[model samples]
Target: MQSSGTSSQLDNPPSYPCEKLLVKPWGWKWRSSYWFVTFVVWLGVATDLLVYSMVIPVVPFQLEELGYKHPASLTGWLLFAYSGGLAIATIPVAVWSEKYDARKLPLVAGVVILIGSQIMFMEAPAYWLMCLARTLQGVGSTMVWVVGLALLCDETPPEFVGRQLGIAISGVSLGTLVGPPVGGGLYTRFGFRGPFIFGIIIAFLDLAFRFLIIEGKSASKLRSNTTEKPNNEIALEANTNSLTDIGNDVDVQNKKVSFVHILRLLFRSQRALATAFLTFVYGIIYSTQEPVISNHLNSVWGLNSSKIGLVLLAGATTIFASPLSSWLADLQGTSVVIIIALVLSVPWYVVMIIDGHLALFITAYGCAYFFASGVLSPLTVELASVARSVDGIGYAHVYGAFNLAYGIGTTVGPVVGGQMYDHIYKGWLAICLLAVGLLGLCVIVAFFYVGEEPIVQSFTRRIRLL
Candidate 1:
């Protein structure tokens, strides 16, 4: 005797024994809370970065211990290997995750792979094996990053995405803040195997957290109905929907869900292209000077691994600004935030040209790192926005491409920077100049082509009016 509206609204509950006792998953409400999902992404990113940078200071020494000549060059090669793996995996992972509607599966699998990499790095007898391990690390990390960000995009609302992403990205900042000191200290005290053993344990913890989390789509399987009607009632309700439901269905149908089509729609946007470039630069900022920094410090100041880690720590203090930068980008638009951060970073890179003041250099370096870090959240948000603008485009397609750009940057940065440092005259100075020039290029492009409405379009509008 129920109305069609009521019948149509009912969800199908399990018709087994104690069907009335069926309920939503235990603690389902909080496990999928806004912050929890963000934390999972944050933790995933943080763990990967932490594990990567944690071993950086130890790499040259480890190579030296393995009797490899020119450990610095080898260190650069290892970084290149890592990046190459990331680049190689980005497309496949993105395509698969989107095609299969999966996020957590890859995330959990990635951590297990990450743990295997750490163990291999800790025990690998040959240099090539170590390289293979690093490459594997990159492959594993990309899965977490590509899919995790896409998941974040799914859970977060459009208006708040930028800020939430900033918060999640702060985990990268935290990882950088903590990783080096811990790695260096552990290595200095306990040798090469110490830090990675810690890493393995941490990876397991990350795996557990990811396993516990339930994505929104997966949660749809849970039972939430209070009224379970007969089979005839279900039949009657199957064809009926309210006007709002019909409208939503039309909207879903209107969106172009084809992966290739969605990708093409994003590719056509200038802002998305510019954001991808910024992410590439982000990879460069973290990787290029990194291989050289520990060597430069050891040669110039005779600092040990522990002390060098402390120095890197001092320079990374600027990472704290990411949240503020994301908030600003949310408020003022991405172009302004991107421009200001890069411009301020220019003077700091110039400080690298200075000769022999460790404290001063660290201050400048940290300041530069801070400014560079600010751009990521904004770019991430902007890139996601661009994809969202394309009807039916998922976040994975854009972030997959995002990971590819970053992987390329990571590969390009260490190899080029390390080679230049090894052979070029005033190479550090040259690198500084190059960084400044690239920053300028980024600023120019961002001003003209980035954000909600680029400066170029406004200028074009004015000329047309004239």
Candidate 2:
């Protein structure tokens, strides 16, 4: 509930070890519930991504063993199934979380994931059945990601929201970064079902933790109760404030609208709508490229699983750059940084298009990922700012929309690229399509989606942290 004159309060950073975190200047506050929930959610997402990473490398070997002649085509279908499930399930899960308490959603989703992973381990039928199991995993992932994030927001205070979100999302990036090598290593030695078995075990462990991790609601609500009401009661007793003081309290409550109303409003909002568009374009380019990248290295470069794992690690370089990217966004605004990053990504795509040079390939890929990584967090932050007055779950829906779009792109990208490479370019076209799609998306994002407007322009430039 920022003041009308200082809505810049919304953009301030939380107090943390970093000097840049100024939003909560009253020193960093800690609550045990927040830390526990963040850890559980991060672990849940990280494990899921790690399991997914194992599949890209494991799939080709497994399919070959299962008598599939065309591994690439089968791989495409499996990826499509997984991403499609995620896209379809995200909104429904969000709606479910809104209707019920988030506490149960994680527990249920985790159980479903455990069941799906176990099925994947036991019933490694043909390619199609594998896809079905992955699809179920996707559904469970959507539930966990959306519901968990919504719950995180519900439990966090507004002042420290960005920092908390930064820490939580880093877990996702960390999972994606680490999953491939670990999964690939296990698959290299133990076989395809090994990772699935591992994933199932981890999913079960996560399920057990869900019930143990206390919900975030009590902390946020309790803080508000202990701090807020006393202020109101004091003002009422003193009678020192004018009618405007009492009216301000009512205004805050009035702005707190229903979840559906917020969704409808966001859909209608130009800024929010543009953010969604950026998300869609970003998803198509980014997700479409991910599956095939490792395959490309394996098939084109004649690299072993361990070497390909190292190449995948190169993409994770962006992880180190994310906090700096967020800081740049905080300094210069997300819109500017996003547009610049998109423009810079064009040449990186060119490098990917010419994959003969290994150095060039890794360099271009790293740059492309760096820009994407940099823009990712800030984009969500900006969109959240747009819908700040809405329910905490509203932010999750916005994020869910982006994930759904990304899932669609990811589903289509790999299959199409894989088939194209298998049939047409003799393995060259896969990278080509990824590059072209990415560059084209940069154009759209720069010119059509995120115009030359800073998100914090109309708000305060600076504010007292906390």
Give the candidate number with the greatest TM-score. 1
Residue 224 C-alpha lDDT in model 1: 30
lDDT (Cα, tens digit) per residue for candidate 2, span 1-466: 4485355533442333222221232212343367666677667766667766666666765777778777767777777777887888887676655555455555466557746755674476665677788787777778666777666666667654555555566655676777667667777888765667776777777777676654554343233333323333543433544465578667655645566775787777666677676666665666555555666787768876667766777668676555565566666666777777767767666677775878878887788777666666666666556647444436566667666666776777767766776777555555555656665665555444452354343233344332
**Candidates' C-alpha lDDT:** 0.83, 0.64
The residue-level lDDT of candidate 2 at 410 comes to: 71
- List the pairs of residues colliding in candidate 1: 315-366
TM values, all candidates = 0.89, 0.76
Clashing pairs in 2: 13-23, 23-466
Q: TM-score of model 1 relative to the true fold?
A: 0.89
Candidate 1 C-alpha lDDT tens digits along 1-466? 5776566656653333334333566787667766788989999988998898987898888888778777777889999999999999998899888777788899999999999999998999898998999999999999877999998888887778998888888888888887888999999999899999988888898998898788875454343334565744534444343454588667756653666776677678877788888889878867888788888888878998999889888746655777899999988888888889989999999997787788888888888888888888888888788777865567888898889999999999998878888888877787788889889989989888897888677779899999
- What is the C-alpha local distance difference test score of candidate 2? 0.64
Model 2, which residues run further than 4 Å from truth?
A: 1-32, 101-104, 111-115, 220-263, 389-393, 430-437, 443-466
